[model samples]
Target: MRDPLTVSGPEGPSFWAEHAWLGTHVEPGVVLDTGADGRITAVRTGVAAPPPGAVPLRGLTVPGLANAHSHAFHRALRGTVQTGAGTFWTWREVMYRVAARLTPDTYHALARAAYAEMALAGITAVGEFHYLHHGPDGTPYADPNAMGEALIEAARDAGIRITLLDTVYLHGGLTADGHQPLEGPQIRFGDGSADAWYERWTRLRERADGDRVTVGAAVHSVRAFAERDGYAAFAERTDGVPVHVHLSEQPAENEACLAVHGVTPAALLDRHGFWKPTTTAVHATHLTDDDIRILGASGAGVCMCPTTERDLADGIGPAAALQRAGSPLSLGSDSHAVIDLLEEARAMELDERLRTRTRGHWTAAALLRAASEDGHTALGRPGAGSLEPGAPADFTTVALDTVRTAGPVPGLAAEAVVFAATAADVRDVVVCGRTVVGGGVHRTVPDPAGELARAIAAVTT
Candidate 1:
């Protein structure tokens, strides 16, 4: 008799994992059946060997990691800025220099390479926090949304899903004096006003392919979005879509928001009707008690980019407090400081340890959920990041035989994978039922490092 867990599909191959994380825990003898449409038709556990034609996955398979927040072009700055001692302000100067050099063609090359690197790290989907638009002189491209289209194409080329976060960057900077006009490199990032941003966003949305791409919106930050009128209208029009914003990543932003608006950035967003269930507040580092309450009460999620936060000297966010306050947690590799979600998952616990001098604030399962399920949810792919029937056939395998993951018992595999494993330990990656990476090598994009180097050089040189 056919197995009860088996179901009909488009005749795609099945996957049998030595161990697969079924949301809460790791289970051995797990088999995942994929249909022609790249969705899981059934999942069965405790199967002894690869069922008939099932491909064998010999590792701890988990849902494909979702990078919920990313600045794709920032990958060019990875090793270049580490030598200097600088604040986030100083780093922005360097980042702006790189941003100034990108055309749509160059941005596509860089993003494609960066997304390919992410695939190698087991990332099946990315939330690209894209803001660099127009030309170096602030003029719109011939197509207006050329830069955004490049990003969507980049993801398709990399064989991953993407939420093209079309960001609105209006003002140059905010101060007690009020909103400043766009200057120098800042000009390219602006769409003149929120209305213009929405106009372009609407066109981009209409053009976007819905199968593997999502059209989302973002408020660059309190500093960049000083005018409320445009974004308020934008908020109403963006129902049922994912919206992200930079909130209090640095104290300067909070101080500016308070000086001009007389409220925290979170409160300002809340006032503008930007805080909703589909919205996510990225960074959210220097939030107040009220900010925490606002985010949690609104059912909005928070994405923590631990490595980027540490690299930028941004203080640790109130992660556990936010989670306890009813906000779901998610993870991101923002800035690509490191592409590994495992490191991001563990750093949340470790950073909290440093701040409170306490241990075990989060369980391994919770961290995994944040990295996988919640991250996908934040990127507008609801019901993704799982191995259940009807979920996307997206998952990765981490070898238990690795030096770092050598000693955990079967039940404790999730903990070992989270705390001890790195991106280097990923053995296989399947996205939409397609094997993108196997034996730790990307199947399509050969020489990812070389591609990244060439792409970065095209922009930087």
Candidate 2:
């Protein structure tokens, strides 16, 4: 039979150790004791072994990774959206039509499968940029938080942590000029006023049992929050929580913002107190110098979705510039075009090389930190993404002995990880000291492809 502990079937934590590494490299005596609340009570990093009875986890210990941004609904559209012509705009027309028909049942099935895949790939947490809010035709449900509950329950079933970045999407575009109305499924998301959306934002429940989920907030964009009241109200409400927004994701958004407010979306967010360390700017392609300055000055985080960016033909983001300006960088599997974390990291650096006149613009260490540490920090989980004392025993172990990464010392394993590792080599994944992935597989009931098929049948047929 398989190892009893292999599938991580809700069994409690025990003792763990091995070649553990955090922001830096691995050290022995790295025994981690996980608490009932999922906090780290003690970390002894000497040659000491667990006293008395013990459980030994003999692999590299590192912080669990956070997918800083995701749109779970889009996971269904992955290969289907690949062959589409036209630009992001044309694809979005098709997306909106699909979004118009989803019920909570469909979202739960789809998200559970997507989150399980994230676990298989060693992503312990995700900040879901969710905005599809109402019934099939943009009408409010009997319970306003029904859609939110579906997402939360999905995370629980997948055995992963989530920060549901509940969103506020108001208008379709600038002053209703050439901008289309909240057409198709857009009506389900709006609350009539930004203040009204703020009221719902405040209703978010911030705690999760077993330390697995949390609620957060997001502003869809400058286009979604056209009114001065809408943006200001949102920022003020989400002051201390994890906040995210789609800022400067597209040049058209910038042009529209300039046409209406005479500023880029980043500048407009700054004016509205939306820029903060707790904030994550998604995509963040097409930045001006001032845009970089504001992002750096605010100390917000950036999530570069290389797969989605390349898939949609969005311009490359200024990752190196954002780093130089003091913004902590992170990665996302936005639109679920690809859920592999290392690919996101590698594509980020490679895209920089493709766009600029320089080579070696970003270090492998930086990419690794962005993948594991920065994202956890940005996710507001203390001591996350590290193997030090007081950090959650959340981690993934990869075999460096593979042919793809045999060229470098294990000291450079993190770099090799970004450059050479694929999801296939991720041998184990742990969340809160609970083994979730073993035999290089995550145990989940719903089939991912089947779930995608169901979603397609619901929306397209």
Candidate 3:
């Protein structure tokens, strides 16, 4: 591969070559030559230069990574949740307290900072499982979708693509036989019923073909919507759109689901036809063999929030076995426990090692696929996860010479990316040919860190 020049014209093959040893990943045999639209227009192995008049971009490239699951506002709880006697349940209590407090303005401010952090961490897109709907009184806003719009604009301000998984969270539990009722902040997240919420969900704004956002759906959980048709009804209205759910993150959730529905959360969700290519199950920490099989056969993907799971003592999902079982894997920083894709990917395997006491299970190649390709699938944008031609030019370039990836060739970049690197190692981030993270900073917004602090202050104090 020769050094390529930068393109200035309206059109030309945007030539980018990998002089570093490449990480043969995802479709290991496939190659790509991408246009400005981020679609690969050509395919072949071996490095090829642009056909003249093309602009060259320097740095090692991988497909842009997708954060398949995120609760952007929760990024604020990173340090706040680790206090005394903390567990997922206690964390949930604090989360409700915060949720009970956010105004649409506060959400936009905090979420803008959160999405900016995601972009800086090499996340090209995020599936924001937004459930902080309505106001403190639980009444519909004058605009109905005002809160949703704030989040969308925040993503735009951050310059990262988003699949807003506008969540429908009805009920406090599976039923009176299940958990409790609307307590603290949980009231703000609920919308009455599956059909009523679906009507409001359809009222969401959508992005254009070249737009950087898509409106998706999420059931707070099977525990939140135990009725058989809860998710199915929502999916029907979505018409094959991406749907996400929080499945069995804790044993208590699994126990409750079984006690009420006589089935695992996964089985209950499957019986209703809510598991599919367009579906994403967040956490999915506690699953039965039957649960695993159902997720695999449905062609659904599990988003492993390794850092958050570890932080909250949430059990690990069967990431490797699930993939082998035919379900794809993806990564997320749910709760922003760490908010680093590299750490998220590495923890996927480390947790497996802890469980099976095994040496090797998930490889760099597979984790990259999950972080990039599988994540894009759940984001309602295909091919945005890789660097192949005609694929979305979404990618993040790390400092090869940095301590995180020291002594690494481009081939090992993927491995180094998984095990050692941090968001700090990412030197440049490209999303749809627009630079989001450059020189260790976000271009569109000044003082992102400060903005985040201010936003959090506004919400907390």
Q: For model 2, name the residue pairs that clash.
A: 63-385, 138-188
Candidate 2 per-residue C-alpha lDDT over 1-461 given as tens digits, one digit per residue, 9 for 90 to 100: 23211224333365555556656565654666666545556776775666555455554545677898899888777777777477998889778877876788888878878888888788888888989888866677787878888888777677678888888888776642534467667888787777777666666563443246667788887778765555676677777778888888888888888887778888888887778899989888999999999999999999888899888988899999999998999999998888988889888889999889667977777777888888876666645777655676677776566777556765676677778987666767777766777656666534656765776577667
* lDDT, residue 265, model 1: 90
Ranking by lDDT: 1, 2, 3
Cα lDDT tens digits, model 1, 127-165, are 999899899999999999999999988887787889999
Root-mean-square deviation of every model = 3.9, 3.7, 4.5
Model 3's C-alpha root-mean-square deviation from the true structure amounts to 4.5
Name the top TM-score candidate.
Answer: 1
**Candidate 1 positional error at 203, Å:** 0.9
Question: For candidate 2, which ten residues in a row score worst on lDDT?
Answer: 1-10
**Candidate 1 TM-score over all chains jointly:** 0.97
- TM value for model 3: 0.90
lDDT of 1 at 163: 93
Task: Please report, in order, the local distance difference test score of every candidate based on alpha carbons.
Answer: 0.89, 0.76, 0.75
Those runs of model 3 whose alpha carbons end farther than 4 Å from true positions after fitting are 1-9, 12-59, 205-211
